[model samples]
Target: MSTVFDFAANLLGGGEKPLADFSGQVLLIVNTASKCGFTPQYEGLEALYRQYGARGFSVLGFPCNQFGAQEPGDSAAIAQFCSLTYDVTFPMFAKVDVNGADAHPLFKFLKGEAKGILGTEPIKWNFTKFLVDRKGEVAGRFAPTTTPKDLEKEIEKLL
Candidate 1:
């Protein structure tokens, strides 16, 4: 079976990073947007990363413009905004579509691993998060409304 490590993504700062590089670590993968209402979640996510990062935990952020055009910035703008605004230190990727025909392969795998409300596969909005265990297996999926702070317990369990 294809594990989460079977995928790769482009980093916001440039270059590609294979998910296999993060194998054996607990991962919190999120589709983010700089202008969305959930943008502030970056702070919480950063906190989570800081809190559990030493314990084999990581947060991989993927910017997306699919929802309300909330993330219209280019990679440079996205990188600058994240650094200056939330001081986010987690790894962030270039913008990608999380729904429809143009969706990223990693996201397609994520949605398949953990369906949303009522078993729906399409992501409703940005900041949708998927939790992956140390084995690179999808553990759970959280909606846009699920705050990163609320995920600490689950993350601890995986650690």
Candidate 2:
């Protein structure tokens, strides 16, 4: 079957990266926006990454502007804001659209793999999360309001 490894994108630091590089690790893929109200969630997300990274878990952050233009900056600006504001150390990808016709192929596949509230596949806002298991299969989808702290148990289960 096709897996996340089949897709590739530009990393925040300017390098081509394939999702396959993350194979065999449980990943918490999140669409982030530095100016959004949920921006504080970065602290919690980073905490999770630090706590579980050694145990085969990672938080992949992707800056997205489809939500109210909350992420209007370029890659460098997004990287600066995330590092300065939240001290995020996890991998960050370039800005991408998470919904509509121009959505990233990886995100489109993710949404198709795990529909959200009431079977909706469209991402409602920034900070929406998708939990992926080691096998690259989607484990669950979390809403923007679902704080990262609340997902510890689920992550623990996967780890």
Candidate 3:
């Protein structure tokens, strides 16, 4: 009976943030990478956050270096890159592994709630997104190729 609200994550700003703090909000949880080809997706994600954030919508970014060592930066560098390059304003968590034994507990719960293509649980690459509804239930899983802009309608429905 574990919900997303049951977990907590370390923020890039250097503290633990319980998911329960975002209760009743539609969340787009994304595993991001600063050097990935899809890095630009941050801009679209920021747009989505700005467009719907006031309506109980949020984009929670988690940087992961498991793929091609694309996100090797520390919290400061990640924060700076996201700020200066993409101007991302949404909440971002400390770097974590999206796939593997050491995967963050929240991610484990998210992947368990929403499997990917062919019922796969592992995140295929960086930028893979998991959408959670207001009730902290996983709504859908989007692949790395799926752009943040592509999830607007679905997010609207949840909101």
Q: What C-alpha lDDT do the candidate models reach, one value each?
A: 0.96, 0.92, 0.94
Candidate 3 structure quality by residue, lDDT tens digits, 1-159: 878989999999999999999999999999999999999999999999999999999999999999999999999999999999999999999999988899998998999899988998999999999999999999999998889889999998998
Tell me which of candidates 1 and 2 scores higher on lDDT: 1
> Candidate 3: lDDT of 70?
98
Candidate 3 lDDT at 28 equals: 95
Q: Estimate each model's TM-score.
A: 0.99, 0.97, 0.98
Q: Report the lDDT tens digits of candidate 1 across residue range 79-159.
A: 999999999999999999999999999999999999999999999998999999988999999999999999989998999
| Model 3 residue 72 distance off true place after TM-score fit, in angstroms | 0.6
Candidate 2, which segments miss by more than 4 Å at Cα?
none
Across 1-159, the per-residue lDDT of candidate 2 in tens digits comes to 766667887899998899899999999999999999999999999999999999999999999999899999988899988899889999999988889999999899999999988898999999999999998888999999999899999999998
lDDT of 1 at 25: 97
Among all windows of ten consecutive residues in candidate 2, which has the lowest summed lDDT? 1-10
RMSD of each: 0.5, 0.9, 0.6
